[model samples]
Target: MNTENDNDEKSMTTGKAQRGPLRGMNPIVTLGSAALTLAAMALAITLPEVSLAWLTSLREALSPILATYYVALVGFFLVFVVWLGMGRYKNVRLGPDDEPPEFATFPWIAMLFAAGTGVGLLFWSIAEPITHFGGNPFSEEAGTPSAAIKSLSLSFFHWGLNGWAIFSVVGLSLAYFSFRRGLPLTIRSALYPLMGDRINGPIGHAVDIFAVVATVFGIATTLGLGASQMNTGLDWLFGIGVTSTTQLVIIAVVTVIATGSVVTGVNRGVRRLSEFNLGLSMVLLLVFLVAGPTVVLCAMLVQATGDYLDSLLAMSFWTGVSTDYQWQFDWTVFYWGWWISWAPFVGMFIARVSKGRTIREFVFGVLLVPSLITFVWIALLGGTALYMELTGTGTILEAVREDVAVALYQTIGTLPMPSEAIALTGGVATLLIAVYFITSADSGTLVITTIMAHGDPEPPRLQRVLWGLGVGALTAVLLVAGGVQVLQDAVITAGLPFSAVMLAMVVGMVRALRDERFAPVPGQKHRLAKEIWTGRDEVS
Candidate 1:
């Protein structure tokens, strides 16, 4: 009867002695984070030009390193996670053998998908493919049929297995150590296999601090992007002006809504909202498939999947060596950085909901299922847009080139529907974007507060509100300074150090799994029995 929800309530109401790091909170980590965030905001506000110059320069200087590091790391994650999922360790449960899954399969997958890539997926599903079709550094010429096909394939490569593998690595490590090994549920705990009790000292504090910084910046950047997209949608739908002020107002309103949800507790607020988002997403997806070139979309899905698989290996390790490095830096590198930066937040949320699942189940569910969903989504939505462009039904490529934020609206407008139907679809799309934004913000608030509280599932309500506002405020400042590009640059930069941390966590996880304590209960017995049977059969 002890569901994940029940366990979460218990963790929150547990006595002070069992509060781990939340009893007083780590002053060093907390204050240091606050000081750095305040300083960044101050500079961005008072010396906007100087801050922009520095951010741009930093990005330029780090582009090569970021590109190389991200490409290699992401490839490694894909291979490593697949091996773990299928290897002998697959049967190792994240918790005890008798522990049933915390939530049912559907809700668990829903929550993970929502928290993992909700807003980013919504923002990019239409825009990325259209932009790629317009032009890419690769050999494919712009606006050609080849470029269109390549566009969907590249979208799949970015949002597919490699991306989710990054999340699975961190999530699997944290869940295994915390739920199975009984460590505190924090980034530091993943290092317990490597650092031992030192995880409770300065080393642990450092890991959690880096996690907090990355999560905040990642959430802030995401919020900025979502606000800009929502503002664009509103302007396209209504007559609202698209300006920084309007975006700021939008951020404020969504942040307040997110804060309210945070106060409602995770079981009620986060879980329910995630489920709702999933439902709405399905409705929107069905609308696109039904209303826009159904037969063509289906064909495109099969073709794109084949193209993606054919190019998977090349794309996985493509660092743009001996080619246009700028393309890799802009598209692939930026995505890798963004995914890594967001991993701590997304991974932690996934870990919270993934208790009691085996390593195999967690790996396949996290890496494969959600990725397949993303593939289908991109194929349907992005494919529809490309089909229109190819058939001369709409000029979506032109609109996407002008402003990526309006790409979704342009695509839906091109559907063979009446004006009223198009307007209704636009309305629904806007509503879906807004809800996705709220879910991301609130979930991020929970993750940040949890890390700060030393992995407490239920941090104080006031703390949640404070971090929620902080995220909103930082997002507003970044938007005013340089808009979505600035936010993107910031996330890429924050990801530099955290990427190293992620690598170390992967090593630690391997070490922990090798320990006898983590071996399956009947693993040795089964091995011996198989070996003896084989020998007897050979002798006979």
Candidate 2:
């Protein structure tokens, strides 16, 4: 009977393999995703101003809904992920109980930090705090001590638990369903509990397609931001003109490097780059801490963390319903939307590297560790800048307001270092940003190809290169068309529907966990009970 059941399962698997769409690819997903990507690119190129105008209009039209949904959804994710990590299901393993983790702790955490946030932290760590200090919708005064504190707290809030929660839930669902249930490692697998065998049907195809589109646009947005910042760094350091043409050239060069990394595979290429990123980030953080107001920065870190913790609930649910719409729309809503958009890509990459870990371990590692690192980074970088502004020693706020991309360089200039040291620091920073750009593009390439290859971890090298170049190209197009803001708006638009899919994923994961079929076998307790019962029966 057992043999027959095994044979039946094999037969079903073989049948699906034989009938799968487009030989190796899911036809619906491949075709649909390609069509949408191409259409978006064409729109951006042919009608640049019109396309941007429409995106702006859409944002304006959906401002209220976007604000409310993002606030509620991210807040719910934060609670749900924490509950999963700490509740009864904490012991559940993403794979078989006997399987050990694939990577060691340091590498795992390093990869998560590098791939999850990439260069965004480097770009915004100073700018965001300074911008918020200048004037935030939540605050009544500008450039005051209270505003400065609020700035750090709000910056931490944006980059902290809420963002990681988005990544955690998605990664948890994908890893659990794929590794434990022996399903394909794709976005559609998260729906298996609800769809069952129909996960191989049109519904499954749609889910994967949505993930592909979101991943592409999300990655493109990051690439666009990185290019702009890189351009700014070049301008500040070497007097290079920050033009669209120069930025496009930078994108092309980096894309080639990323393609090379993708060809080397994850273990050699992605892992090494991630480790390098971690090391360089540490050096930058250390320098900032040592050179700046170290004592004040430490105090600010403690106070800001406390403030963030105390106000987490209020800030999480604050939709700005009756307050300043533009402020909320620009900052909070935009951040939530951006994080959600990047969830599929970052979440999928994390799941791929996170096999053989327990649910609780994965959740905490993804949520807590990186988030704390982010807070410290913001404190060291942003806190130092805020202190400078308050003391009237630096004018970073003016630079940030004028061109946010150059905020990091401007802040570094204000440090009490010599001109030569400042120049060297700027050079190192540029190098770090470039490598981070390559890391993001390559990892994104791997994830996109895996989806396109129906969740094959080692997809074709050609496909990887294609997707890498495609991401770079899309970034260039958006940069020329409407610059970084357009890219931002585009990602938010893509993220709205994907957010709903993520909610469904949460429901499916919970439902699947409730089913006893997936639970661990009863071991020591059952054996002890049996031994006692047998002794009593024999005595009787």
Candidate 3:
């Protein structure tokens, strides 16, 4: 039976793994991404007013779209929570296994989780609170007690369960259907129950292309932010100017380091990077707790957690009263759309790395654990920054508003070691930033390659390199032109289609699961082939 199953898996692998139009096309995709990035940058520099105007126009167009979609997102998450519970309780397995493990059964899942989330979290841990301090457009009034509470609450809302819910649903749906049913792992596969074979053609191509573009921009944005932060650290520590030139050089150096990792592939490069990041992060957290204002920070954390719990529901569903429209439009709607746009790349990467895990495990692990860590961060780092600012220990928030990276540096200087500690922290943060960016970029490249190759994992190295360089070039262009806001505006716009795509995915998963005869039988050659094609075989 085992021999037969092995042959069956071989048969399925041969039948399904073939190059599609997107396979071996990374160079073209890279060049395309680079061109748009350069163009965006050029407009920002050569025609700043026009660039800003275009951004405004896009925002206006996006407002109505997000308003309509925000309601859908609420409904969408509720549906996801239901299905996630059902999938978990039922012990549903997508491909070959009768029962998947409660947690990620693969070692690489750790690498994926760490690499995908670490950099973004590090960047936002300090920066987002500062952004919030500027204003919570949703608050009853500017700079009120209510405003500060709302600001922190909304930040949690953005980074919490609902946000992860979007990612988990799309990711699990794709993995479940693909692995369980021998469908290709693409956006079109997510809609196969609806579209049938039509998904294998132009429509599928369009979905894949949209995902590719979004992933490219997402990675570029991270690279730029990370570089900018590193530049600020250098300027603060060594009196170097944090100019765009400095940012570009930082990016290039980081890219070189990342390229070496990409060459080693996931096991060596990605895994080591993730472990290093997590360890360094814990060290930083410990350092802050011991060396900074320990008591004040702890108190703020407890207060913030209590407040976040109290306001969680209101913040998540608040679409801004129609009468007050400003808060709804600026904060709630914009963030919803932004999360929607980021969902695809992040979701896809998660799904790819999450094989051998059950739905419930995936949901809680992805949704709950990340949120807990985020709250901790907000309580510690964010809480510390706030303490320093409020007590007049130093102008932390003011410095942040002026420049976020410098604010972090200045705040750190108030601690015991001063220069040595601050420099070391900055260096570690810079290293963490580079690892996360590369992890995200490399994972994206792997996913795109799989989508193009009809779901093959081992894509050509040349294709991977093309994606790496493409992401680098795009980041350089966007940095040079200082078009971060424009890119952000574009992200908001692109997110709407993905929201619809996720909706389609949920419907498809339900249909596929209910069609009982489609279920696989163990030790059967025919079933084994289906399992392999769908990436369900336990061996993989």
Candidate 4:
């Protein structure tokens, strides 16, 4: 092994991992992702009008399988993560036996929150519940007690464990393989058990190429959406024009800030930004809880929590096969696709910051803590909207229907605080959205650097900036072309390949975990992956 390491070092020094004069860069992934991005940009620019027609036709053909696949993927991940956290492998550490976590609990959890949801929580916290309250298959009649109850409960369902489970599954597999075993921290490493050294060849490059493209398009879509929301917030607060020029400015500003964050590296730039995002989220959440219908929100929180927990099992598998398949495809299936599309970026970010945590610790912490905070955040913000609608003090549902972007501003507008304080709250909400936007972009930048550098968590600063700018440029071009939805559809297309990749990772993870190093605890028999022909314990 030492001899092999020496040879490998010599090879890297002789430029196996180098691209001519460039050091620590993988040209295949870098150029491949860039080429893919340019192709997508060309489509979005030259043919934005009919961009969705082909994708719509394609998804229509694949809708049944795609929806079923995403649903099952989420369901399988939920069970996999819960079992890891609670069952025999609970004690397995992500690193050496005595290794301590790199970040403290608070910062770790804070960064986890930043990586997972970011701006979407603020954007949807007000919009989604109100949409459901207006009615779903569960309640076609709007503005009723049942609708309100179902609203918050459904929000919990979408934002809760199902989404996080996908992240956890990917993060856990990568962390276990990278840290516990001696592998590079890249998606290809997840297949080492099945592929052996073949992961170092074309197969590995192909997998990573797919991951890079998916991640690039995924984050670009978010930048476009987040910028639009920020544009709306600015117009609502400061009367700025909601022109494309305004949105371009917003995108440029976010790109510069995110680039700055990535340059400082994770310990300072990313970690500080994440902590700030968490703190600001709490400040906004607490203000809403205090200044709004405080008691009613609390009561709603309890009832919503109860409802979410009570109906989790049923709802987890409740695809709209029988009733309103379009509705489920639009909402639940859309979200599942969104999460899957983001798994590479978010999951890789989580794994990078999550060294030294036990499997149990990582699983539960990722699943429960952020999820509980989300519940409270949604209940506070969305619940306040429900209360106003119930009492007829505000037209939140109307605003949501007309324009979901104003939903947050509208919720703040109706707060019982004085007129001046309402303006102050609006400013804070806007700032929160901007910070969430920055956290997400910077986080994606950092994660992309690793993939581009072939899994170096501390990748080159130049490459980091390049990746960050790449995302910004893609968003700007799409925004200017009026083709963000086109880019988004392209992301959904990219995600189909990755969906298969995720399933492969799962099978490899199961096979890899059965190695002798992860033998059963004392007196507890290992769940046998019995030998069928060879001596190795393989799942037959």
**What residue runs in model 1 are displaced by over 4 Å at the alpha carbon?**
1-24, 516-540
What TM-score number comes out for model 4?
0.93
Question: In candidate 2, what are the lDDT values of residues 198-276, reduced to their tens digit?
Answer: 7777877788888889889988988998999999999989998889888999999999999999888889999999999
Q: Please give, for residues 103-166, the per-residue lDDT of candidate 4 as tens digits.
A: 8999999999987998878888889999999888877688898799899999999999999998
Q: Which ranges in model 2 have alpha carbons more than 4 Å from their true place?
A: 1-23, 516-540
Each candidate's clash count: 0, 0, 1, 0
Report the lDDT tens digits of candidate 1 across residue range 14-103.
222334433435555666677778888999999988988998999898878777888989999999999999987887877766677898
lDDT score, residue 136, model 1?
80
Local distance difference test, each candidate: 0.84, 0.85, 0.63, 0.81
Please, what is the TM-score per model? 0.92, 0.93, 0.84, 0.93
The digit string of per-residue lDDT tens for model 3 on 1-540 reads 686457435423432423653434433333444465567656766886776687778787767656656745754685566566555233455455654443333344455456446555666676676567657655556444445545566667766777777777777777775665555565566877777557655666566666666666666666776777777777776788978888878777777666666666665666677666666667778878887778877766666677777876666656545555555666567556656666666776676666656556667767777677677766677666665655567676777777766656666766666677777876765666666766666665566555544555565666666666756777777666544565556666656666767777877776665643333333222233433233344322
The TM-score that candidate 3 achieves is: 0.84
Candidate 3 at residue 225, lDDT? Answer: 67
Residue 112, candidate 4: Cα error in Å is: 0.3
Point out the higher-scoring one by lDDT: 2 or 3. 2
Between candidates 1 and 4, the lDDT winner: 1
In model 3, the Cα lDDT at residue 448 comes to: 56
Task: Kindly report which residue stretches of model 3 are placed more than 4 angstroms away from their true locations once superposed.
Answer: 1-52, 86-90, 98-109, 112-116, 137-149, 322-330, 516-540
